[model samples]
Target chain A: MSRTEAHPEPPALAPGEVRTRWIVSTPPILFLSLFFLAPFLIVLLASFQYPGEFGGLAPLLAQGDSPDHGLTWENYQFFFSDTLFAEIFLKSFLVAALSTLLCLVMAYPVAWLIARSPKGRRDLLVLLVILPFASNFLIRVYAWMIILGPQQALAQGVNWVLSALGQEPVNLLFSPFAVLVGMVYVHLPFMILPLATNLEKHDPLWLDAARDLGATSWQRFWRVTWPLSLPGVFAGSALVFIPVLGMFAIPDILGGTRDMLIGNLIKDQFLGVRDWPFGATLSILLTLAVLGLAGLATWAGKPRRGHD
Target chain B: MTRPSPWLLLAAGLVYAFLYLPLAIVVAYSFNDSRLNAEWVGFTLDWYRTLFNDGEMLLAARNSLLIAFTASLSATVLGTLAGMAMHRYRFRFLPFLVITPVAMPEILLGVSLLVFFLQALHLTLGMVSVILAHITFSIGFVAIVVRVRLHGLDEKIFEAARDLGATPWQTFRWVTFPLILPAMAAGMLMAFALSLDDFVITFFTAGVGVSTLPLQIYSMIKIAVTPEVNAVSTLLMLLTLVLVIAASRLDKTFMKGAA
Candidate 1:
């Protein structure tokens, strides 16, 4: 079916049958302008202004007539110049990347299971993937705390097994590794859902044809299935990785104090120190990074799905 | 595609285990009589009783529900209009303007909204700002959902209605509204859930004056994990699971009818 297209102009309205698609469209546009775009623009502008002790925002707009107030790159410089902030940024990127990689590896089989399973069972399996995620994310992370805490059964059991082998016991909590585990657990469903969507439409007939041509299972997968599923892989990775970068809740609850992520830094800036200007700067930069990655994902998801 | 191999089955099973292990622990620990360990100090209903009487937790719950319902209703209305616009008219930048919020990190949104509320609008950081923030981000989800439903629409039905002497409003009320109702419900459900479970954006935008369930729970966790918090978490999980399952069933029935 053809899509419902917006008329360039109402052709000619009958006296009783008035048409105002433009008017119909106004509410959302105005809402977006008021709530989303305008505020976002303010953040962009605010990030460039000079920062003060508590918050750089006051000097910029709250006291506009003050001669000392002007645009400066100092807020950005503050974040970049500090090695601690730099390390945090790097760790955020690294941890997000690693989590995405782990999710991809773990998600493939689950996606395949849901995609290739009996049609009647597909929705149930999909719901299973989404259920844990639907629950409060904080609760899920809390669950991990219980499992990974030093005195927990799993941690102690692992430690006991190691000691039995005459090795040192592992400290699982408050570590970067714990953060990674939390991230992977949280985002695995995201990776699987998109891949399952892409894979569900993949015809089993291709495998039969490849086998008829004497292609092995691995060869058929590598040659046909692998290439066809790339869009889903890219899409899912973007969904998983970007959020993982922004979500510091897992890291905060699970990660140690030494290595902070960007999310943690932003929280510290805004909530802890109450520095609005510098926080806005960091947030803007993080927003840009997320946008870049989202663009890449869209670019990758486009070539295959564009026609559909 | 014929059948998954043994390794694939095993790996998928492991993923399910990994996903549920934490949640299962939360439920199991809610009843733990012991303070912080898995010693199984014997199961007790004391935590549930504590949660019952916690005035702050109850207040936070009420606030979360109010914001969720209000935000979801408004987001659905606004998003349905936006979705209709995209379907009927060709706006050049609607997708970017509408969807960027979804792609934007929650922290940035919180920070931007904070600046906008405090500096530009001169509004206090409180419940009003939190609702607006939730609505702002949530419209994207509703828009996307409604858009998908719009795409699945059979344009011929609308054309047929117009041909049969139905006016635009009459045709929409008689035909289009009925068709998209389920999708709208799905969108509303998702918006409600997103608002309820929201943390990162809510955290940043919510000044000290406002405490949603998440913020309240966060402060509680920061202090220490208590059995009461575990009870709250369990109840929250139960609520979420029910809503999500209901939503999935709705979508399934909707799709079946649409097909």
Candidate 2:
């Protein structure tokens, strides 16, 4: 009844001819168990415990006197207890949503452009999308730091113009806008990849047919192109949204110390507050959220474009 | 069909601009002579020399390269087997489960793995722990890549090999193995790149002074950005750009050979 029933053969693989199905898959099965499943299980168990000192956990069944004491919902309660915590949860979701939206807007056109290009150009564009991701993410974020720093050229230009107009130069770094800019910068490629893959598979003949039938370009897009591209949009959104939801580095570097997201909250619990149990609880909550989103995406993936 | 709307092309150009400009700035600023990043002084390579001379930075780079090499090798092996199994057999939801490590927020993976090692296994956190952690997350990337490559392979070839009285071992060695080798290598390279660039998971698993290049860069930036950080970052970007181009070339050659 376990989910990982190792390689139950379908009717296709004749059972007698094979040595055994499970034998071949055992290495990967064991690898996933020892590394992934076991660690996740530990986190789950730890999440049920009381917060002990310095990244330690009290026994899950231990006794408690106060709300913050042993083996209580206290840790979980405390995390979601305040309005600020709730605000952070909502804010993280909103930021991810907006970021995904912005990525969609920027990426769809680019993905479409790449898909429609000739082989040489298309490969070049896709390479452009991928080459950046191969570099360090922190380095890229740090790039944004200097670019938007008050003393940087762009900011200095703004200040020069502002001084002429007798207005003060604006602080750009460590703001919500800067966070959005960084999120869009980092996540754009993720959005582009899926959408481009889907678009590349689309037959240009569909567009030709619609045009020959006297449909306007806009009508053709709305009637056929948009519907056909929903799967890509869905896939891209899922990819972009999930990561942006748990984004720590961007918010930390760009959003400043004032605006806290769920990742920062979780990081604080472990490193700053030293509440291992509460941090574990938050991790579990995020895992569930991730799974839920993935499930929703899978369910919605009807592949109605008729291309599977 | 309608020439892709000039607007789309413009947008694509802008997207590329957005992606590369920050990186270009880093590369440009690495040559900046002034310690202050605000204004450019005369061009100089002093920062590059500084980064080269920093013993700790080089050690971290060496550590990262070693760990990435080993982790990617193990990941390639695990991924190849998993891809073959998924291709040969049917397991509903297996693909979904396999991708969870990659799809789940990396922070969760880092935190959970850290807790597992420290609290549950009581394993010492160092290069070994970091390598194990890298292999764990990277397996999914390799598996997905190898699986996609395997999907394009013709199953009839396997049947033909079998019909010729080749044993399963021979079929795999001569037929399957040769065909998927490029993909496996690409997967490994990608895993290598991912391991090299990882920060969040490495941050958690690499305990007690075991710093990778990204961790080294992170620490450096956490205090303040210096010319050395810029120089080192530009070098990382250059390395990655080279790796990606090399991997893509391999992929293209594989496609040509397949065709």
Per TM-score, the best of the predicted structures is: 1
- Give per-residue lDDT, candidate 2, residue B144: 73
lDDT of 1 by residue, B86-181 (tens): 776677677777788887667777778888888888888889999999999988888777777777777778778978999878887899888888
Q: Against the hidden reference, what TM-scores do the models get?
A: 0.92, 0.91
For every prediction, compared with the true complex, DockQ reads 0.59, 0.53
Q: How accurate is candidate 2 locally (lDDT)?
A: 0.82
Clashing pairs in model 2, backbone N/Cα/C closer than 3 A: none
Report the C-alpha lDDT of model 2 over B94-146, residue by residue, as the tens digit: 56556788888889988888888888888899999999999999888777777
**Model 1 ranges off by over 4 Å:** A1-19, A52-56, A61-67, A164-168, A304-308, B253-259
Determine which window of 10 residues in candidate 1 chain B has minimal summed lDDT: B250-259
Sort candidate 2 into its docking category. Answer: medium
